[model samples]
Target: MNLGDLAYPDVPTDAVHLLPLGATEPHGPHGPLSTDTIISVGICERAAERLEGEIPVLVLPAVAYGVTRYGSAFAGAVSISEETLRSLVGEIAEAVGALVLVNSHFEPEQVETLRSTGLPLLDLTRRRNAERLTEEFRAGSCHAGRYETSLVLAERPELVHADRMTALEERRVDMPAAIRAGRTDFVAMGMEQAYCGAPGEASAEEGSETFETLATMLVELIREVAA
Candidate 1:
């Protein structure tokens, strides 16, 4: 449901507030810049549909900005400090009795911060639980890859640039390796285009399947938390 719909006074108090957080940044030339937010909203809306009136799941306005330092090298990428991201998420969680974070980006530091907020955070990072779904969809790589491209194609087909996929390159960086070496050298990792994986393989059908599975998983997690 829309955020405006939640403003009704008769709305139930025990409803689980679902906050879809995302970033407004580049996701390769094939995908939309707001891919993260779009994916999050799609999944949240699907989950809310399944829960219906009985679950009182409300879709809050998505956090359109996120921490994207590595991608900042790209022209359209914008990022915030880890502290700012954490504080912002914490404030939102405190405002609601319980929060189900629908995250599309794989920012570990930001995820950890949101988790530490003590809210019922549901991790949907490509590097985490979403990895399995990625495999199922044959979506390779982690960023602006087959999975993300497919999801965007499924949810917002008009926004994708399928013909440009062949020009994009796969640039995978081992974040853990850099972290262990005490070097904040994300730019030097060779991800100049801020992209990884094959965007050309994305399809609307595959995207729909991945979205359905993710929505189901999120709803199940919410039910467990409520119980």
Candidate 2:
């Protein structure tokens, strides 16, 4: 159930609250800046539907911003301190006992910040389904690439700027090593164009299938945990 659609009395105070977290950052030239949020919400929606009558699940309003300092290039990226993110998540979880987290942003720092929440966080980025997609998408660069672009196509096709696909496939950079090497921005990591991976190969069908796989994985996890 959507929290916004319910009155205070109708709110499921005792239900399991699920929170989707995303980053308002650059998602390459072909994808939307809100790609992360779109994917997060999409997964949450599917998971909720799968568990409809089985569990009391409440889909909370998505957190539109996150700790993604790595995408500081080509505009649209915003970030907050790790402490700030932690506190914000903590405050939300405090009110509902615990908030099950679902996130689409894969930046190392952002993932670290979310993990630091000390709450139950189900990160799909590193899951088996995502691992397989990484092979197909060559997503080691960890930015707007085939995987993310396809996800956007599945969630919001109109948001995709198809005219800008594959312009920087050859310039894809390895972000994790760059961060470890003391580099601070996307420009330093070789993402001068603000995206990586084979976005040109992304298709809505691939995206839709990937989403179903992820949602299935999430539902199974929630069932295991809830059991």
Provide TM-scores for the models: 0.86, 0.91
Query: When superposed on Cα atoms, how far off is each prediction in RMSD?
Result: 2.8, 2.0
lDDT (C-alpha, whole model) for all candidates: 0.75, 0.78
1-227 per-residue lDDT for model 1 (tens digits): 65557557766678788888888788876777899999999999999999896677878889888877656666777788778988888788787777788888766666776776677766865356656586623342457777788888888888987678766655555555554566443456544555666676777898898889889888988898778
What TM-score does model 2 achieve against the real structure? 0.91
Best by TM-score: 2
Cα error, candidate 1, residue 127 (Å): 8.0
Q: For residues 1-227, write the lDDT of model 2, one tens digit per residue.
A: 88867899998756777888898988777778889999989888899898988987888999999888767656787887788888888899987774688888877777888888767777755656466454644346647777778888898999998888745464566665677899887777777778766788788898898888778877876776677
Candidate 1's TM-score: 0.86
Collision pairs in model 1:
none
Which candidate number maximizes lDDT? Answer: 2
